[model samples]
Target: MSKIKITQVRSTIKRSKRQKATITALGLGKINRSKEVTATPQILGMVEKVKHLVRVEEL
Candidate 1:
């Protein structure tokens, strides 16, 4: 599987509960925090939900 880097670029404060949960599931809850994960459907869906809050790079 291809690897994709997920980085949290913004704060989660005042965001919806679901958004925060998605960030946490991605192992990123802080600014500049990043995780390289496989590009599975579930993971990609989660990323899409928080696309504004994160930056993604293919590896």
Candidate 2:
């Protein structure tokens, strides 16, 4: 299976509550923080939710 590297490229201060929570759920809170997660359906959904606040790379 493939994996994904999710990085917080921007802040979520003024974003929606769900978007902020999504960043935290991905193990990121501040800009430049990153986490490696499995490319599961659940993670994919979360990524989609906050796609604008993060940068993703295949791993």
Candidate 3:
């Protein structure tokens, strides 16, 4: 399996609760925070949900 690097490039403050939850689920809370997570369906869904707030790259 491949891995992906997901970076929270934007702030989640003032955003909706769902968005904040998604950020937390992705192990990202502050701007510039990043986490290397496996590429799974659940994670992919979360990434798609907050695609605007993050940057993703394959590793």
Which scores better on lDDT, 1 or 2?
Answer: 1
Note the clash tally of each candidate: 0, 0, 0
Write the residue-wise lDDT of candidate 2 on 1-59 in tens digits: 79999999989988999898888888999999989999999999999999988999998
Worst ten-residue run, lDDT, model 2? 17-26
Q: Write the per-residue lDDT of candidate 3 for residues 1-59, one digit (tens) a residue.
A: 78999999999988999999999999999889889999999999999999999999999
TM of each candidate vs. truth: 0.98, 0.95, 0.95
Badly placed stretches (over 4 Å) of model 2 are none
Worst 10 residues of 1 by lDDT: 1-10
- Report the C-alpha lDDT of model 1 over 1-59, residue by residue, as the tens digit: 89999999999999999999999999998999999999999999999999999999999
Query: Which segments of model 3 are wrong by more than 4 Å?
Result: none
Q: Say which candidate scores most in lDDT.
A: 1
Off by over 4 Å in 1: none
TM-score of 1: 0.98
Ranking by lDDT: 1, 3, 2
RMSD of each: 0.4, 0.6, 0.6
Report lDDT (CA) for all predictions: 0.97, 0.93, 0.95
